[model samples]
Target: MPTSPTTVLIVGSGPTGLTLAIELARRAVDVRIIDKTPGFPRSSRAKGPNPRSLEVLEDLGVVGEVLAASSAPLPMRKYRNGVPIADAAPFADARPTPDAPYDRPRMIAQWRLEEILRARLAEYGVRVELGSELVGLAEGRTSVTAALAGGGEIEARYVAGCDGGHSAVRKLLGVPFEGKTDETQMMVCGDVEAEGPDRGFWHQWFDEDGAVMLCPIPGTRSGWWFQAGPETDASGAPVPPSLDSFRRLFAKHTRLPGSGLSDATLLSTYRVNERLAERYRVGRVFLAGDAAHVHSIAGGLGMNTGIQDAYNLGWKLARVASGRADPALLDTYEEERLPIAADALDLSAERLRATMEAIRKPGGGLDSAVSERTNGLGGGYRRSSLATGGGTGRLRAGDRAPDAPCRDLATGTPRRLFEAFAGPHFTLLGFGPGTAQALREAAGAHDGELRAYGVDVGGPHGLADDGGHARTAYGIGPDEDLLVLVRPDNHVALIIPPGDLGAVGAYLNGAALERA
Candidate 1:
């Protein structure tokens, strides 16, 4: 509600908005974040961060806390007639690699993850403004004015609609959100305390009449995440989700007493609704997270995709907002994330169908949903305009910048490639000594925006690829002269011959600079 203009206005304080706010603030950009609710929701709603998201969290500097507070996904113990029949650990084989670390998803509650992000955001002297709802929005050529519920108005350079499903900002832009809702795939989910199952394994009881699943919440003693296949009447209409109905279904499916389940709060019903926005951007306003797309909850991709969307947009928004790059740089956010969301929609639906099929068979479980195969590691923007030169070397533009173990030339100690790429700056990893002068010159020309490092290159004190791991990971020979420009989000923005420094500058300039 301050009279001064904000650089970015983020609507919704969920994972999406929180991630964006942290990204912009860490870059020293002025950002304002708001949520409609008066207080933070405490529900253990979504499962937790996937493998790729853990990398994002590491970049954000909160993975240690997440790992301390969370646990790995537990094996699902299947039961028939209240007797244990099978144990399935789909993600057990997921392990860390030098290129892609943090192999599996953690099992923290959604509320706990948000709390950690909020604490990290506070380190930057910013806090979420709760109870502030957008009532009206006015957009102009280069700025947006958002009117809140309490007769307050805010002016921002850009408005990001991280608000979920029914987004007010998306509505103001009049963009169409298209998808289908399958009522037949209904579920009732909640957080509760039950006396039925051990805390080590996720318990699932299946019967001809009904089904119930109880998974222990990582940080709670008596608390468990409860999910149930909906109970139906003779006509097959789902009995509405309620306490008594949930109890009846649990008792009917399992041999455990109905009275054992208690404190069943934060209960809700969900139908499998798959939808994507027609477009992510409408002039000065952009939609992200569930605002831009919603998919079946299979594969645990719902919150993870939104977090990925925020990460992809955060660095671009910061660069453009800080005037280091052209606003056209922002267009690539949609170009990159929309296809990922569309593909995730299909992946989630396919996994959901497979899960349902498995539930009907003996020794069947949701292995496909929990596999690293469905994780977001394989996504990139190779086809975008920014990718050039046939993606030379083993690493190509539009591909993920792989990490490796190396030596700090200055200290003669072990270091990680990710350690150098940790902050909110573009990284240029140059191979061979001939590119050293250009790397240093480019770093000086861009000031602090671009950081340059020489790998296995001869200099007084340049980084040494002691094991040749960096060269192997980057797919470069010892004598090759390659310049790999890594975007702030750790994607290879441009992989060019060492002399093409102008190409790097032009890529950052974007169309916005030419128009100016």
Candidate 2:
């Protein structure tokens, strides 16, 4: 078969692949994405998107649409013997604030999230090619040739494997996926309709046998996600999940009448398995999302982590393919994200164990600490290559840059500090007047690779007299002046004081600066 040429090719149309395509398209990179599935699945696997995931979606300009379609501040209800025991809306106080407005997870079904992402991708005039599966991969010095199931081939400067756990790309690369599958804990999951309960709260019932969890499926009438411990036969063989099986399990565990439940769809039995690829990239072929790592479903971080992986790689891939930066810049993708995946694996596994243990202890509720952290807000890349050190009272790199309302000197319109951090560009934020010249010089030196913005240190639009939200976000004192360099990923790349202009230039020119 003849090889079709493209700048970048991505396999799988899941959140990870679609996010990569959207990011690359926003940067005007010519890219194509292929998936084996004919269309999106209607089942709700991942219940919601976390705060960190929301930030990434916000950058794609689809957070508003997602928010509108999502249900948030979901009250977690615990029931015993078909009677409500405790009901607590954990994030009832959560509101959208400047630093981290998405204080709680938005309970939107994974299918609906994909729909919103597809709509955003459509805005860039790109559609996912369905029924095209990756069958083979051959790499050369400059490009990768991928064989398609459609009896064709595609040649692209780079290929990313966003395909799920049983990734053919990972298999083709001959990398070892090391992990263990928990045979002890098996789950039967399906989407079903319940006539007796209102679709408002997520309910969990715990007893000596096991626990059954049910959460409302957002945007679906009478739809809910049902998960329960598996039932094994006399031979120890696992019973397959079906509508009848789900009905029976719910009736036995939660004591809810099974007759009221109907229309169970997409039933499947699964065992929680944790795994991570030994490597994220090999030559020109790369992996992201489930292809790279898989973990327990306790936190729902599996899909969110994959979305973040694509967000981190999208701009870097665009730059390298466009010949703007050195290909070595791609190495940082794994360096920054691999450890994060490792942390996520450990955290989720721990949460699963803790939740199980809690069920065994009397008067034990879900650990509030574990529940809050599992939401993905507390995860950070403090040890990434882009991070720099700081002492007490100093802003450090690798921390999320703070946002404050500021006026754009050019347009005289009020905007948040995050506005300057938008787009795939290096942003130099000046804390005072002197850094303006430094920013100008750096912009000239880096040319197309950097963008500079100046934030004055006076008045209502400037840093507050007492160093308020902006000060805390940027970690600057009211009297101190400095320049903060933010990467396209919205991470603080470097914090430069008055004398560090030259250092900033060298840093931008170094490998840390992504291509294009």
Q: Each model's TM-score?
A: 0.95, 0.93
Q: What TM-score does prediction 2 earn?
A: 0.93
For model 1, which pairs clash?
none
Judging by lDDT against the true structure, name the best candidate.
1
Query: What would you estimate as the lDDT of candidate 2?
Result: 0.78
Candidate 1 wrongly placed segments (more than 4 Å) = 1-4, 233-235, 390-393, 458-461, 511-516
Q: Candidate 1's residue-wise lDDT over 188-306, tens digit each?
A: 98888887478999888876656898889888888888889897889988887777777888888777778888888888988889999999998888999999999988899989999
How well does candidate 2 score on lDDT at residue 173?
99
Question: What's the CA error at residue 137 for candidate 1, in Å?
Answer: 0.7
Per-residue lDDT for 244 in model 2?
79
Clash numbers, per candidate: 0, 5
lDDT of 2 by residue, 477-514 (tens): 65667888887878777887857887676666554444
C-alpha local distance difference test of each model:
0.85, 0.78
